[model samples]
Target: MVHDILITKENPFENDVLNFRDHIHQFCSQFIFRKIPLSAVVGITGEWGTGKSTYLKMLQMHAEGKNKDVIYFNAWKYEFYEDPLIAIYFEMESKFKEVLTLKKYKKVLNDFKLYGTQFIKSVLINSISYVSEGIINLQDTKDNVKKIKEKQATLLEKRIEDLKGAKELVDRFSDSIATLAKIINENTDSPLIIIIDELDRCLPPHALKLLERIKHILSVPGVVFIIAYDKNQLSHSLKTLYGNDFNIEGYLIRIIDHEVAIPSLFSAEYFNKCADKVVLSNNIYIDKFDESYKGLNPFAVTNILMKLSLRDQQYIMHNIYSLNNKNKNITKISYLLVYFYFLGGLKLKNPSVFKLFESGTITKAEFYRKVLPALNPLERDEVIIGGAEILMAIVLTIISLIEGEQNPNNLTSLNLNGVNLEFNVHLVADVKTRMTTQRITNLKNIPKLYSEYPTFSLD
Candidate 1:
């Protein structure tokens, strides 16, 4: 009989609760304790359902302990209709307004003499309209003067409508945060923190736009943005926008003045909390058996092992592959472990539960297929590459990135040496294709090996 591991902690990771606390503590210390608040832009990179949004929510809880006026937002499912920075600012102003009405913050609001309503309006309007004397006046319309007015009038009306709609949203956000910041600043005298969560699930294009928009967009200081993201997705995104010039390592450091990568290490105490909540509380495992979970990839091993009997625990734990593969030095098993860790975490949550059962216990296939190639799509876009399909599209885009965007016809067909292959091999090394296409002579003409096309992913 399968048993569900009960987790007592707030961890969304069904069974694995690791070193999230230290990460939160350290990140809070760096941003809150240090007053060096630059235009901090952080992108939380992770596969979808790595529980990044939950992690950010936890950070919001911790930030309160340090006297930061936290403004929390989930970009997923929201950034589609609205702009992110403007959305953030709107949230801030609203939070500020809310704080002003509180008895403790009322004095602060009065002292600053900040007319919350007006400040918010001006900020919103300023953000929306980039009107200059020349553009506003009849200056650049000498030739197409009549035509220019009609086009300009339509553009102006649309801009007005957009800004007006943004105004209502921003007004609410501004009122809440503006007053909140005023209150917090007045009451405790600390920098206000604005946390934007779920960049990975957010519209990637919108997220891409948000990164460009946030600098001048969120015109507030003393506001630290704790952006939670997974690096793999962030790199994938960076490659999409910046192309060959995408300097991911340098860019991450620059964007995040203070970056706190969810520490790779897992803590036993958090596990105790998890066991108390999920497994041990139900007496699924013996009291002493909890210690065996230590040193394993807290991301995967504990969750997988704890789900099975202690005997099965020994088997899964010993073979659990680490998903992280960027390091060339690590064993392939370790990297595969990272891959499985994420996939296992994924399975522990939702629909793919049966897939794990279908793949059989670890004894079935070890070398040929590391993790089961389920090819399942996640509900949330895989931050790793949005989702598999988006990732495929992005890979297609990058295929052209290596070969310039100018040519659209030959995209599907990759040439080996001088000639176009008999059939354009859209995707390669498909284990299914290997078996099916082995008999076909034309398969040799198509690109297959990673050695041939060094630029292809799997890097």
Candidate 2:
């Protein structure tokens, strides 16, 4: 079950979807072995759910095998903290001791450990933030005014003291990073590579602050930071912090030396890997699928799958398996219908339309209107109209029986636009819809839903 589990220990599927792994590995290897000035931040950016974390895990494995110091830090895990910078330092301190020899780097380890507790306290309790700069006017009694003025005077004095100590705190933090980098350079033969993941999942403030802190304080020459995130998302987050006019690319250029977008997973080989798993697991045959129908054609379907994330592809495969297991006779056609539902951006978005089809309330016109635009961009001559008509009618009959229509038993054939065909709708069992599709269109593009999501159907 590749659902919700992180691909940590195992390497990626190199002979399959992970063909991109070799290229990414070669890039990281070049950066490490070439010894072209370490301690720069490299970004592993991609859209959400595009196997960024999985790629990092593979990269971590590659680096570890080369004896490079590797730390896999998850930024989202510590987003609860007020200052993620403290959490960042703590994660590094915790991992360094585990990987490095204690006696060999005892003094440096101790220095790194010393700042963790004090920094936590300073961020949690003694931190001062800008409240307001405008003058205040109040209507109050003289005694109240006097007491407020005295309190302000005391607070102002304490703030001045805090401001005086702020420089010392920053110096201590910088010294620790520099000291750790130097000691690691001395003790270890390989560069220290820290892979920070899920930076995009952090809160807007935490994400921005973490990058700023890394740029200003923790930047050391021998330490290489590989951060995995969606750069577009991070840029949006930066805008949330510094207004719409924020120079996000400029800010990122200062922090990150190399920005690499995770390559797109768009290959027919990968699609076949997923499709083969789904079809064969249920003992279904590929030839039964209408190869002449462009949408169900394996190569044509691969084009649509290419646009989806790996997780989404899994979700679709799982759904197909679920649907296949419940029906026996028309297994091949059902696969096309399920895939088409997903390809056309149904199943998850527009439940009203989905429920119409599911509940057998979808009229012929409604089904045709909803499904036509989702078909492959081919002229009528390119598609086998006979296969398409028969397939659509078979799917409609299945929907009718699933919705528990009366006398739907012994349904052997279907008629579509005067084209008659044989089908086995009775083979479909009385199974209810199992999974609930959430409204995640805000987080993702729901296939063709945006431009093609429909309105109330008269039929």
Candidate 3:
């Protein structure tokens, strides 16, 4: 499993949705992160499965590590209301009320009686969230299975009954939830770090409204709304919503003009670090990831690979020819070359795609063709130069999964048949709903093939 970070042969670091912090390290280190009282909104751009959420988390942790006040929220989730700005108002109200002492905390609560219903809700729901999400591995037990099952059955029945009453109580009190979040932030040592992911996944019209709302309101002090986005797709979504004339990047520029693009949150260097941490140093080699290929970006590499295997991607042109000589209006293969590097030794295990959840509006295929394209534009001209190179790096990252290179950072696995990670192929939408998807590119391969995508181990 790609879950463990230490004492595992397969790297867990790459899987750290929060590992992409290099982009903000400088700004954070120099200007606000360690030095000043700065309230800045750092945004990220990536398609749905490109792992923006994980990387944003890494950045937040990195900031918090440096002792900065960080607050984060996903606008797509927070801006579910009609005003959307209420999401903003809720944020402000929560922070202010939290500064009060126990006495103040109570007085603040009394003054916030209107939100009593919400406070109960926030606490009740979060009390459940207070549990660690790490899956517990049970040791083998040969005891009485039937009796254990009966006991668990009784416990669940009692718990469900208790929960039912609590939920009803909370449903009537939503405002207090906001107040609770504020109090929670106040007691924490670091800044309030709120990560709002899947911005580009919402309805086009609704998403645009939320974006505008964030621009106007989410900039409150002590809260650094770490927004995760895929700019290439987001702009397109905006076009669909506002108009063909709407310029999404331009609109984003007017407000969130500065964005921290994590070029290689999944870079070879980072993954290499992960491998060393998890596995015995003797089992891995230093030069396995081909250090010189650093300049190539990750996305560009994956893009070219996807295109090449697409039916061998032949090109044909028809033309009127001269006497007897066949005339083909074939232009130069420059565009193809422009897009590809030598298709070197490489193999990938696209993670098995599965329907995690579904709402009536969002389907599995629709998630990719519609949602994914915007969140992670697999094929597109990028604003940042060297996109092709960036993709080359990505190709190697794929190979890392296949051959188990740098398995320390983020362990990727594959069965003999391969894997395909997808989300909501079945669309069951739940509130606080996350896009149900898979990490699809987990891979595995032998040494000879491993040498193709990533460098071979020295050992």
Candidate 4:
């Protein structure tokens, strides 16, 4: 009855699983497609794997459906290119070619291509020269001094000329974009909308260069930019460029006219659906631990899942699925499902503490202290009221089961805050026997045991 955990790749507009249609409609109608006097850069910011890419896709489809010209550019896909401007220019050129013939817009495109290349090259050469001047030895001599002075004078003159040319080229480039935007707006009655996605995934220099290009050259009338990125990750990239002490918020404010946060996908209903697809689909018994132990609180579990990114949520679920699949008999003991869920949360929320606990380097009491503060008030209350003790008892019971005991005599009499919680020793034993066969002797081996499952990194 187990089902594989497949990452959903269907179009968000088609499926609308995350219920983003309303948000997409509102943003497009209210801000994006609405007529404004000046061009604007709007940022759609969210944490990594919070569905920024999918959201952008939805926005693009909506814009296109409204008869607005939309350009979807993924910066990371072109990170290998030295200059992001080149990639952006090509993307614009390609998209525009569909509406206007290449010959008609060829001159503007060529001018942009030629000047942008020259400007970038000039900057690189000047930077190299400036650096070289600092390291080069310049010894004074009657003949060499005159020569050096002459060379400096010539270089300074050329540098001024280059600067002027670069300025002229930049101005021309801006004018070309303005003209193009005007033409497109006149033809379609809507400003050209460009959706720049995955900018946070690019190298620091590439990402910063693209941002600079947008601010200085591409921010023209009749054009609007919707940039999707992880704000924190992009901030880190900015810090990598400007220094750790740089005012990231101040700088971003100057670049982005407005920012919209992606709506969170966490809710009790969402978690229940994920659970159905991941855990319950396997026919696992998750209703009650025993006559004394009730099922996991849906709200409490939602709170924990909310603490993790979408990628982490899937990761935890998939690992749990792998564990249950490997030891099918463990599914019969409904209470163990609670422990598994807790373990997954522990591993994700505080990996350092989880590692210590897994290696047996920390006791149950120590683990409890470290993880308690991370939980919400409700979860904290649950932990204090028999949750912690019951978890420890279950671990001991599982260990005893692994040791081939008919009954864990020590755990049989275990009491949790004056309440006795019974254990299904046979089911617990089955889990251990499978683990033993897999060479997993202790908690530390669990990660290795489930290492075959895919893992994702937060941006």
Candidate 5:
């Protein structure tokens, strides 16, 4: 019973997993449909795989259920276009055709295409001018190129005219959208909710261009935008376009009327539920492993999973299944599970450190410095300071076993050449209680055990 590593984009509201349905409903009914201003841009900010896409889907579902017109635009999907406006225009055109008759939709959108073409042409002509400026200057005195400059001079005059008409083009485009929105509003009795999703996944240039177009052209009455993104990642994209010193918050404030942070989905109960979903088989070893670790603090596992993004959590869970399957013969199933879980987390969070640790080149001090800091504050506190006795026991037992120690039941400390790493007395006791003497003796090849699990790339 192998589970797929990726979670399907099924409507979580139907099942109400993670209890997000109430939050989604409240946000849609209270804020989005009722209180939010028409033509407002609402930003839904969260890290990647923190369920931004899922939340947006739920919002769209809820909004449509309430008879609101919703258009979901995935910007990253159509980012290959030279201009974001072109992609946006086509999406609106497609959606508008659904509500209005084909003739009426064509009539309303005719002016939009006319002005949109002019606007796009103006941008292209300007780019050509900028790129060919140097060559034009260098070839100015050549008799062969003099006519080219004269033609370009005439075209520059026309470009000046096009520049003057730029404002008109923008206004017509806006008017077309407003008219469509009004028709939709008249039919649905609600403003059109345009959800722009995956903006953070776009290339930096495309992302910034999309933001600018949204702010300038798409800001109109009778239309509201809900943009989902990872704020930090979008900030990085902005910094890549602008300098690192650019004020991202200031720029976003001008575009977004409201900012909504997706709530954290971390909890012990939720973690256990997700774990159960991945570890579906009722193998005797798995049952024994669960029973043995039932006394272990839930945070011990939760801390590791919570450190990963939601997507990475799924991957590690899948990895856990693989690890458990490969090491089913091992008697210390609980210890192996915890060890592999921590390793999978380390692999995802810091591949470089994981590589070093995997190569057996990382010392204990290096692990303390690199791996400990790689963990989040809660993970560090739990896995190092509080409720870390089991983890520490696993680490010490593995180290002692690898160093040719037959039974580490009484092993309290290790001398790593000059460095002394002490183990907690309780950790040794816990290890002894969980693992038999024979189990420790048999689990000599820690690296070999790790080798049984497949290697994977984060990318």
Candidate 6:
């Protein structure tokens, strides 16, 4: 039952071949504790589903062990709101409720609440007019003299100035932000680390607003922000929000102090480890297969795994484990199964070709032309491998089952392009003899192989 329950997500401490989690934690620690600048924005860049969020979780865990304050915020969770300032304000407030008693940080919390309300209101009411210089000719109408009326106008203008000058209003707003940052830093023992994840997942406006708000208004001395996203996506977002002429890289440079790319975690060693676990834990009899038949390019398989999420990885492994457990000789046909599962799972490639072939709607020549190239190319030295015969058997077995004829003897008699497929049929018969009816039925359904991994491609 080793494969019964796959690790749903990677553990922070689980070191892979790349030690990705450890490297992220180390970077966060070094950047946050720098002497000169107490506040910094660290950008963790990776394409979608490359596990940036998981790395942030590991960093949070490491920071917590050292008694540092960590605030994790998912921007996508509150993307429904028009204003990102509200999203950030509420997210911080929610986190504070869990960690610190409200009584101590009540004033600081209220400052955030008041400033957020005012900031939203200011954006909404964007056109406040300054006092005009024109004098009213109400000298005769008023009981007071003309000179007294003139003095009244000057006094009224001065009073209005005292109420709110444009510069004064902006300074007050900036002071409110500084107060909030100072109070939180002074109240907390360690520096506050804010991890903003899925920033790129937000809509173009929301993403740009969040970045702008963080860079301008919320930045403070004792706080550090780690923003996780795909740099390319965010750059595109900025261009969409701003014009095509926008200085995307320069704008990013102003916000992100240190940018680190998330490394590809699917090394050859890592995938081999995963394969060993799937095989041995499921009691799959892969050893009986000839070495050449079992051979596949690890690099190609690892590249396929890279395009998938951790969740997808777990799912495909579970399917393989279950299938191999049922059909003890499932490993014999795994060469094609691995490629077929991924191709069908992504569905970006041609899966219709397989369907046509299985239903006897396509010729063998058409199947070879359309489908074979999509599969991982075997090495030139391994041309004599029995994989081609096994592949043909797999196709014929499925074609027979889908046509309601599961008999191996009947399966071997299928004519492909006027040539007798006798040898391929025997290969199918040999493997089918070791499998149960249910196992063969499972293999008959090709979509079952694909249905588990989502058809959606991140690209």
User: Which stretches of candidate 1 lie above 4 Å from their native place?
Assistant: 1-16, 34-55, 102-183, 241-245, 249-254, 267-459
> Deviation in angstroms for 205 in model 3?
2.5
Tell me how far the alpha carbon of residue 121 in candidate 6 is from the true structure, in angstroms, after superposition. 4.3
Return the TM-score for each candidate structure.
0.47, 0.69, 0.40, 0.74, 0.77, 0.61
The residue-level lDDT of candidate 3 at 397 comes to 36
Q: Tell me, what's the RMSD of every candidate?
A: 17.4, 9.5, 22.2, 6.2, 5.5, 9.5
Q: What would the per-residue lDDT of candidate 3 be over residues 35-80, giving only the tens digit for each residue?
A: 2223445677665445565555555556555444444556667655
> What is candidate 5's lDDT per residue for 1-459, written digit by digit as tens?
223233323543653454567777777764456533257788999887676776777778777776677889999889888888878877777777676775756777677667667777766666665345543455455676768677677777776786778778788878878887777777776778899998998999999889889988998877888899998899999998799998999999998988988777654444455566766453413332233332344234435433666666666666666655665654235665666666666666787877765765554566667665555543334223333444555765665554455567775554322333355665666555555544544444433444666654433
Off by over 4 Å in 6: 1-11, 14-18, 33-38, 94-113, 120-190, 235-250, 267-340, 345-459
Q: Where does the lowest 10-residue lDDT sum fall in candidate 5?
A: 284-293
**Runs of candidate 2 exceeding 4 Å displacement:** 3-16, 34-38, 127-154, 186-189, 238-247, 275-279, 282-306, 324-345, 348-459
Report the Cα lDDT for candidate 3.
0.40
Deviation in Å, model 1, residue 449 alpha carbon: 34
On TM-score, who's better, 2 or 5?
5
Best by TM-score: 5
RMSD (CA, Å), candidate 3 to true, equals 22.2
Better of 3 and 5 by TM-score: 5
Instruction: Please report, as a residue range, the 10-residue window in candidate 2 with the lowest summed lDDT.
Output: 430-439
Q: Report the lDDT tens digits of candidate 1 across residue range 253-359.
A: 65565555564432444434533443333333322312322223333233432232222232222222110122222122222223333333334343344243334
Runs in model 5 deviating more than 4 A are 1-12, 35-37, 101-127, 130-138, 142-153, 281-306, 321-332, 350-356, 361-374, 377-389, 404-407, 410-459
Cα-based lDDT for every prediction: 0.44, 0.59, 0.40, 0.66, 0.66, 0.58
Give the better candidate number (1 or 5) by TM-score.
5
Model 1, C-alpha of 297: deviation from truth (Å): 13
Candidate 6 residue-wise lDDT, 1-459, digit = tens: 123212223344554433565586668557643332366788999876566776777777666665556788889988987677766766666765566566966776666566656766765454333223324444346575776668767867776775575345445555655555455556554456889998998899888888988887667666788899987888888888788888878988999988888875644454445556766565553333445444334223424423454445544555666655554444455534543444333343455764664344544456457655555443333321243334456555554554556574554443333333233445566555644344544555444444544333322
| Model 4 lowest lDDT segment of ten | 1-10
Sort every candidate by TM-score, greatest first.
Answer: 5, 4, 2, 6, 1, 3
